[model samples]
Target: MPPAPLLLLVFNRPSLTDRLFEAIQEHTERPIYIAADGPRADRPADIEACQGVRDLVLNRVAGRDVRLRFQPSNMGLANHIPSAISWAMEHEDRLIILEDDCVPLPGFIPFADELLERYQGHPSVAQISGSNYQNGISRTPCSYYFSGIPAIWGWATWKRAWKLYDRTMPGWDALRNTPWLSSLFHDPTHAHYWRTLFDDAAHPAKGSLESWAIPWTFNLWTHHQLAVTPDSNLITNTAQSAGTNSSGTSHRNMSPATGIEFPLRHPETVSRNEEADAYAMESFYLGSHPVERFFWRLRLPLRLAPLRRILRLARRHLTHPQPGA
Candidate 1:
């Protein structure tokens, strides 16, 4: 069977968009849809960059089965992406989604395609993610594992799943104030962090925040759904600073694009990996609180023998006081 159509979300980043588009061209021949959000009017160069990105797609992808959706005005990531995705889903039952910054490995296309078909109408399966943040630890024996945390670096979902996406977070008021909110996350810190995010997005009293993925994630969790992730990462998030909202960088969570050899090794049972999910909560979703960061710093020496040696030398120098003497 043919793979689901792919939808790409781009903004004023022609270089990154070109790299991603090339990756898609290298891997699969699935029908492609491109959505380019308009440039911010304040930035004089934005319009030129945005147009360059659109032209790059048009010129390079000429004669291919491609569709373009260019926004007339800047809708920002919050509005542009979800609306573009909804528009793409109207033409197909499922879609493989990518952002300008996300570059897929060779296996990513097939990996998402297979799982998209496998979990087609399964209400419990929320999304199929190509990115894995396990830091080389294989948490499950299966080729793919399940978790409630959805990774959007590279992913696929069905119309059924997308239909549940709530941008306004309609039931936020009741859910936000409930005791049950804390129970949803394994760690209280994560619960608090997510609550803050949901509260900000829902009310936006400061008019500074706007997003769709947080609400979409909340929708999936409320419905008790899981996302499937590969044992090895098949996608790379390359743009952490350039034209992106992602803050900070980590050695553990970021993986280089690597291929997954298939006819896929399917899991014997469909069950969520609680350990993996908790790790995601503690490690990725929630920034290390003061206590967690302290613990991590304490554990660093043990994890790295070189660091232990350096610390010991420093301690000995301080205790001996040889230089001052």
Candidate 2:
């Protein structure tokens, strides 16, 4: 069977959008759908930005199967992306998603193909993500590990799964006041961060997807599902530092993980690696915290170890084993 069509959400960044479109061109026989966010009239540059994207798509390779959805009005993030995804699902049973800033390794398409095929019927399977947090946990890889973070960047989902997506959250607001919901997702630190984000969105001046993905995470946990992936990250999040909302600081040297290994059979047993999972959550939370910034500065030398540099370099180079510090 043909792989699911790629659902692409594009906005202002023509440079990044150009690169991602080129990546899609590199793939074979995959249908592509472009959801171009409508232009904003009041903000002149934002209007120019959206116009630039339309120009970019028009010049690209066109197929009878290729499709586009152009909105006449700016819907912002909450509407543009979720609606774009919905449009894709309406046309196809499954979809692999991409934003303007997500660049894919060449292997990403094949890796997604393998997992989508493997887990099509697995009820416990929630979603497949191309990005994995590069936490050095168990060296023994068991396909992909379970994470509470339902990252939308470089992700794929079936219509059945996305049907559960709740952007206009009702239960979540009530749960935000409860510790039970807080503790279940773990890391009170990150929970508070999400709470703050949602609180900002409560009045709604703009879109907040971090708050939106919480429901998906909650549903996954309640069902005890797992997201499949290789030991390495297939997609690089290029948006963190470059775009509109940098969220304070940006990540540099963000390289896509190499070696997209495909597993033959899905692991029947689900084991929750508490330490690995907790460390993953804790690391992200503390890294963004002010005190930890000072702590990481104190340990900068240890963090910038020669070994760390070598592994980072080697992660992109399949030929070389990471050099010893």
Candidate 2 deviant stretches above 4 angstroms: 135-139, 177-179, 182-186, 195-211, 218-225, 241-256, 263-266, 285-325
Weakest ten-residue segment in model 1 by summed lDDT: 299-308
Which candidate number has the best TM-score?
1
The residue-by-residue lDDT of candidate 2 on 55-121, one tens digit each, is 8887874553678898988776656777888888888888888888888888777777777776777
lDDT of 1 by residue, 15-92 (tens): 898888788886446789989899887777888888998899888778888899998778888888889999998898
State residue 153's C-alpha deviation in candidate 2, in Å: 1.5
Evaluated at residue 79, the lDDT of candidate 1 is 87
Question: For candidate 1, what's the RMSD?
Answer: 7.9
Counting clashing residue pairs in each candidate, in order, gives 0, 0
lDDT of each: 0.76, 0.63
Q: Candidate 1: where are CA atoms >4 Å away?
A: 245-253, 288-325
The residue pairs that clash in candidate 1, if any, are none
Model 2: how far residue 19 lies from native, Å: 0.6
Q: Estimate each model's TM-score.
A: 0.84, 0.76
